[model samples]
Target: MRNILVVNGSVSGDASVSRALVEVAVQRLLGINPDASVTHRDLSHGAVPHLTPATVAGVRAVANTDHELSTQALSDELIAELQAADVVVIGAPMHNFSIPSSLRAWFDHVLRRRVTFSYSEAGPKGLLTSKRRHMRSFDPPW
Candidate 1:
């Protein structure tokens, strides 16, 4: 069975257009693959903590170190979820021409060094090759 991860970044929750788009996408995906499993991470409802100096330090720290932080736990969970997914769908609303803070925070946790990507002498390269679809919502008259 394929694993599909859906991330909702809209502050308007269920009423947001981004979420509606995600729903449609999910329906289409399930229609294609009946055995696919869907998992959701509602960023607005469960806001990801903003990265701090301590969080960065925790990320760089050695595993099983004396200094254990909550950030490490959170990052581990987020990264694991991303790594396990065969497909990812992100629903983000554009605010001031940028992504929502919650969505950005979610990225921060999942986009870990040596986890989601790695740097070589050439350049930074992504480790994740999972199919990703980004759905953006805008103020609309359409």
Candidate 2:
């Protein structure tokens, strides 16, 4: 079974354009793939940890469990979800004519150098290869 990670990059809990867009897409995605599963990670619901020195160190220790970092249990869960995705769909809004910060944070969490990408003579390369990439936006013309 395929797992699709749907990241809702809206800052507001209610009346967010990104949330609406993601909802519609999630429904359509469900219709298209009956067997596939969808996981929703809301950028702004209650709270999510900010990527700090402690958090970064925690991520680095995932490979070797002996050397641990942050004691928060959610860090391990978050890292696993990111690495296990079969595809990633981000619902982003142009804040100040640019993508929202949470989406950027999501990238920071997932786009680790050795974990999610590789540096080669040909330059940087993506470690994960998925079938679909859907980035939708709803912002006033700017």
Candidate 3:
């Protein structure tokens, strides 16, 4: 089964233009792929885990004897989903000329070593195929 992860970058809930646009594109893709499964991650709806001292520590720990720091940085569930997803749909909106904080948190979790990316002789290679990235940027649109 192909997994399609739709990342709604809107920090103002689903009502945001970016999320709405992403929803429309996601629905259209679903219409074309009835057998496909979709995971809609709404960042504005409290889905983002805060980056505390422990969380930051965990993300940086590669061989921590304790799981506390690692768990705080990235959850098993999210890492698994991110690694398994066949495609990622990103809704990028400008918030003060930058991506939203919630979206940044999502990136932090998704963009990990030996998971989402890896180093090779040709520089860093994306674990995810370039074709898997379906991005739509707008002037506050998805």
**Which candidate ranks first by lDDT, i.e. highest?**
1
Question: Model 2 clash tally?
Answer: 0
What TM-score against the true fold does each predicted structure earn?
A: 0.83, 0.73, 0.76
Q: Is candidate 1 or candidate 2 better by lDDT?
A: 1
lDDT of 2: 0.65
Give every collision pair in model 2: none
lDDT of 1 at 79: 86
Q: Pick the TM-score winner.
A: 1
Model 2 RMSD vs true structure:
4.4
Clashing pairs in 1: none
- CA lDDT of 80 in candidate 2? 66
Task: Give the alpha carbon lDDT tens digit for every residue of 47-140 in model 3.
Answer: 6665665455555445354555555445555766776777777887898899878888877766677766889999998876644443554342
User: lDDT rank, highest first?
Assistant: 1, 3, 2
Poorly placed runs, candidate 1 (over 4 Å):
61-68, 130-142
Over 26-67, each residue of candidate 2 has an lDDT whose tens digit, in order, gives 666667777878888887753455566546655554533322
| Cand. 3 TM to true fold | 0.76
